[model samples]
Target: MLERSTKIESPGVLKAGNPNKSLASWQGRKTEIAQIQQWLTDKNTFLIGIEGIGGTGKSMLATKIYDEIADFPKRFWADVSNGAGFSDLARQVLSEFGFPVPEQETQLVEALVGCLRSGQFLLIIDNLESLLQPDRQWGSLFYGDFFQAWVEDGGNSKVIVTTRERPELKGFEWLTLKGLQVDEGVALLTVLGIRGDLTQFVELVDGHPLLLRLVADLLKEEYSQDPDLSRLADLGLGNLRQLLTDSQVVGIHHRKNVGMVLVLDASFNRLNELQKALLLNISVYRGAVDSAAAVAMLPGSSAPEIEEELRNLVKRSLLVDKLNGKRRFDFQPLILAYVRYQAGDQSEAHQKAIDYYRSIAKQPPWKTKDDVKEYLEIFDHFYQLQDYNSAFDSIRICNDFLTLRGYYVDKVELYGQLVSKWEEIGARENRNYQAALIFLGNAYDSLGQYQRAIEFYQQSLEISREIGDRNGEGKSLNNLGNAYNSLGQYQRAIEFFQQSLEISREIGDRNGEGASLGNLGNAYNSLGQYQRAIEFHQQSLEIKRDIGDRNGEGASLGNLGNAYNSLGQYQRAIEFLQQSLEIFKEIGDRNGEGASLISLGNAYNSLGQYQRAIEFLQQSLEISKEIGDRNGEGASLGNLGNAYNSLGQYQRAIEF
Candidate 1:
């Protein structure tokens, strides 16, 4: 049995109080607060949903309600805006309750529901809109299941969820939080120390909380010396308000957003050059922006200068300072859209971001998750600049890392986009286009879509031959052989491998020759030609050593072990497999590591060491799941079952 750790540590601190202190001093929302308090106190109401548009002060209202609800024995706040998923939230909750969280998704959900039912806890899930799917549904079935369970079953606990979009769920009171009342908006302006009769100004902004705050901040800074309501035209509000009012005839949605855009535009015009440049440049990023990235985006600006500018933007409400684990900056969705709109034709900025990310990356075969993330950004920047060739090149450089990490679905999508772009530009004959086809084929092969894989590989082969590219032709042949091998067509695979080997030798491509030999060995092993497979694997191993290809050498060694194991040489197989495992670990090739573990488990099982085999297979199963290798996961489960069956533990075997 696997000795699973039961220790539980919180991924984030669960302080049981109002987390949004920034809005503590702000007034308004008394009526909203009272209604939410009633829902919290109501025994029948288990879930309270607060929904609104972007700038309507939903979070602020939730914070107020949270602070006022002091009767609950437990309170937990989770901010989902930083891209935390359902599992992350569950882990935090379970840890807070001091319960061990299971690794499996279903088990985790069950544990969380049990915890929620066990107490009268108050849970506030903020920015739930961030976790909602693009189609306005729950992003995960687990989310739906968890919430549904909470509603169907009686629980002492109450849940508060705040979102820009309302989720369609039953057994809940939905509060459509709108803009503040005119009196509340005027009070906010007054509190901000704006010395004016701001009733007309507040009414014009439709009592939008964030817009009122932003306009006040701008006025406080720019017009502090004069501080008169008559000089509002100096800040462009006169013409801007007219434009927004006239545009209300377009649509209600447009009318709602036009006020925000006009306010953002007025605020943007007041920024200094560096501040404007920083916002425009960082707007290209799809996620949060740290100071380091901010500084990189603006060349000739020192770190201190950039930090000051970032703070200035945060103060001006143009950027949100996300003080989670790190002090990073992000924009509200509307703000990001506004800045990106203002940054039309930001190809130069995108290129700068690309260069900065590339500069920080370690040379290819990126080992860290952070490196892969940066490469993803680089690819996006290239795509934004319409440099599809460079974008695909970045994808090519990170292809192995992506594969090892089980990013096949994402890889397929990226390559598909690149292929469509190439076809659009009539560049199907380009080398990158051929590479994209091969990449798509490889992704499909990894995903077990062998027929689709064959289609793309065939297209790549045709393109390679048409362009007279021998190396690409050899690669296509090798990939096709691998796909056939996966499909159990060993003889067909061998024929493709033989052709690939011939091309490699003719082109003097030693690396390609080694890959072809290794693939041939795999096909022969599948055919039960143990001695012949060993011979081919040995040749491939020698070439890998000569070329210093550690990953390939490890793969060849594992293949040799597999062949030996098939010949009943269990001890020899163990030694070779162990060496292969070590190499894969050193190279950070998680996919290879999992394969070697599975082979080792099989060898141990052959020796009748069922307990040891179970341990190895379990480890392999974890790695397979981590790297998204569905085939490896199935193999690990099957191997473990065989070991359990050998021990006559039929029930345990069936569980596997």
Candidate 2:
């Protein structure tokens, strides 16, 4: 009854050649093939769905099984990589069976079903997901349920499908293909003559067959130029990781390989306008995005509307559920990069991402686990964008929060990136340029790279002097003092601090004066001038309190407590440290609280109060662990061990 497009071929196994022999070779999946074989040969089995993301070799596997199966009298295969109408599909299938395709749809359906019922046949449809639709109506038929009757009749014919999505039909065998195994991946890489720690290369690409093949080809070409593998080896993990994660690389193809851009584009083109927009929106994130972020990024759409679109995209295999049932989604790296490139005019989406992340980064000092999670996401997005101006602005806005929260490495990375951009943009003398230098210096200072810290500080100071900015000069001078103090050049640190103090007093900048006094006190304490340290700290505390700088006041109290402890005045130290701890708690400063707790523990230990020391150290450790403060955690652990040792509990100390 079906209108056949061509005559059927004689019954025999389908012959094949490995596609893209240079880039792809069929290495493994014998287990999967045997599983499909077991199901197809079973009398009760009616349908099989081979599902995976693009480039996982679904089509290849389907063809392999079709060739291996021996008993089918008639065989049919359709390359529906693009969407096809039901009539076209029926005609193609009928033509393969040496039957004429009928003009009438009802007659064709009846004839096809009758043919399958009477004789043995094998039908293989590749990319079946493309043929499905949300509405399901192809022409007086629901695509989702069209195969139900054929499958239910218990016919001799068996159907096998390869698709990117799970078919909505019931009672079908489903096999989801993942990445290739390590040995197989390595064999593929070897075909291209690209060398590395074969395991790490496979692991880097997560053993995704297409990715491994594609990246290996690129690296192979690069290696061909010199045959010196060390060039690639020099890239190291950081650079290599960046290169592999870039979706742009997947779009490349040699004469042998078809680019992933085309594969992903097929999936992307099937999406509706809103679904396409949503895909683009999510691609801006560095990693998985939760439902709330999705809703926030697209304010024009309601939450329900966004959710519905997300589900549809996931069903279409354009988006994936990163955290199952938790409502977080992600795209495959190549697919995301492809979608971002295809979705023209993405400035609006990029701006939306920037605003959302900026708001998150500006929130109160990231106290909770959720807060830290959100900031990490924000940092990831910023790092991925690599927009120097935006990154610098965010750093300035959240400077104190980043410093207090121990995000110094991130700061250093961001500043380093900003400096590169400044050089690229040729803005060596701008006001923001000096500010970036100063911040970078401060980051280096915090990391104990005092010499590097002084280099950047001096650069900032030079710029400020040329521009006649007294405030900038004073800040840079104070930063230089901090660096010198860290390097044990106390006299040099004092001279810089004295200059900063003079400028602060001359310019009537009370905040700068307090900061300078604090630096002087720290330098004197490090030099063993405990009484002089106390004098400067007292002055700094009075000024901070008078100026209503509660954060600064807390810092001064903590410093005073540390100075007193160094002076062997345990009582005085405990009193000041307790006050500092209370202030930090009131202000929701977990880092400050942890530091004060450690100080209190040390002061108590000095007084032979080992039990009190343990108690304080335990609390400090908990706070550090909660806030992800690694430096604080290390200090707390060390102090706890000391307290245990003092109590003659050597085993407990060793355990700690």
Candidate 3:
């Protein structure tokens, strides 16, 4: 029984790395390979890096070179993207070279480098960009140092790395790989068993290897069912270009590659109903997905059946499968873009995805990274369904988690989409539309983009006034006041706060009234009016306590603490801030807790208690980092600097 289960499971695990066995037949890049071969044989060059965007065949070319180089005494290959780090690569090299592998990372790397320096070894590192920073620098210092040593001291041993970005290192011959020539593309299609002359098709795609292969596979599949080339003939270059233009896939647009979009559209069109449906449904996913998730997206489909379909899609070049600890499937960027564009009117599919993700998500107050990720999927589905209210609700539930956890940019993007959709539909006066504008404004405000925040706030205010929504009007006015205060325009902020206060009073919205009072306090505090700030904050605190708004009460307490600290009442400020911190902790408001800690740190620093101030600031920094609150993190660092400076530890202050 165990053996049977294992056999059944083994087929689903797609092995990764070193596609040498699978890529037996190859075409094109002969010129490029010869140049690389020359570089490899050159005693002066010890390293070569092939750089290109995805689907340009960087790995394929590297594998081809590896196969061609039989004269090398030793050859090794590692796919860096598939969980293979520098240490893993080192271990492979040491073990293969008959050297005893060291357990320590430094020792292992040293051993590998020593072995390479002593022999004629060739190492191929695939997807090297995975180990590189966005700025084209090595992500790991160990890898960088190892490579530098190889280039400087390795005798006769050569290393080739394939990446999307060229690493910032000297002593390496760089190859900026491009798509195949038209003739080469034609030959490749023929090798893939594509019938008919494909010179025009190849030219249309600009000889992009992956697009050609996809189109060829799709054509071959169609030909297998019916030996008719009429369909291929009918899709002339003109029609193909028109189809690509009409699709409007963002990836294709960015590449400005007419052939890519056309080929994807043709391939997508040739898929059977089930294949098309599966592709469209799975397009909702952002990244790698397992069989279970794929099965969930296709309701009423058996796991075995779905797995088989997934394999079929992989064979057709619609999906790419890999084993990164577990079997998963993904798409190339262009294909994902094309599929998303075609995924319209798939409400049932979107709902199925929503249900699947929701079923696996933890209940609210999402405690794990996975829970937050799942909610993002739910939000996406709701947005696709044009269910703006539910989508906004999803965002609201995870607002603090998103804001504090470095997902504020993502939150802003989601709100931008909502606003765009509402405007597209001309629903300017809709409550959700106004709410989305306010939410976007608040996001910008939190990010310190005060000008953008004011723009959104003004839009929301206009919409609220137009719709006679007094509560929304008050909220928008309060938000506008906050934005102005952030910009240091205290009087302008006060004017907005007064209007919001009047609206809140007229509508009997106790929460809005409290929020407006708090904004007034903040503006006054900014202007150095400590006594007036304290009075307003006290009023806000009373209203919040009456309404049982614990979060609001904490904010008011923190505001009063700041006002007292400004007034040089250090001990009194600490007392209020401590209370505020406790309330925030009890209510699980990490952002508020961070704010209170910073206030306490400032008060202690003012009192000449530098060490005590540092302790509080350090805690604030930790919380800020934990919650992804960049602004809070900056504030904590600046305050820590002040405290250290007060203690005459100028170096420590500078470091902070």
lDDT of 1 at 336: 73
**RMSD over all Cα atoms, model 2:** 24.0
lDDT of 2 by residue, 1-656 (tens): 00011111101111112111111356788789789888977889888889876667777677676665688867877655323334456655676777755433435566677667777888777656544444322211324444777777868788888766665568788998877778877876676566767777676666667656545543443355643334544323235555545666562222112324433444455457887778877776654677777877778889889988887666544665554446577664335546766766655666677678666653654542235344444443454565556556655665665565444544665566667668678776677778888888987777667898999999888878887889999999999998898888999999999999999999999999999999999999999999999999999999999999888999999999999999999999999999999999999888899999999999999999999999999999999878766568778988999999999999999877
Give me the overall lDDT of model 1: 0.79
As a whole number from 0 to 100, the lDDT of residue 615 in candidate 3 is 95
Those runs of model 1 whose alpha carbons end farther than 4 Å from true positions after fitting are: 1-21, 25-53, 58-177, 195-199, 225-231, 239-244, 247-250, 362-368, 447-455, 465-474, 477-557, 567-598, 609-656
Candidate 3 regions exceeding 4 Å error are 1-26, 30-179, 182-208, 211-277, 283-287, 333-344, 362-371, 585-588, 625-630, 650-655
Tell me how far the alpha carbon of residue 120 in candidate 3 is from the true structure, in angstroms, after superposition.
26
Q: Model 2: residues >4 Å from true position, as ranges?
A: 1-252, 256-275, 278-281, 289-328, 354-401, 426-435, 538-542, 545-554, 571-594, 615-630
Clashing pairs in 3: 404-627
Please give, for residues 357-419, the per-residue lDDT of candidate 3 as tens digits.
Answer: 888877655433345666776777787688987888876777777565434345566788789
Best by lDDT: 1
lDDT of each: 0.79, 0.70, 0.76
Q: Candidate 3, residue 232: CA error in Å?
A: 11
- Give RMSD (Å) of candidate 1 vs. truth: 8.6
Predicted structure with the largest TM-score when compared to the true one: 1
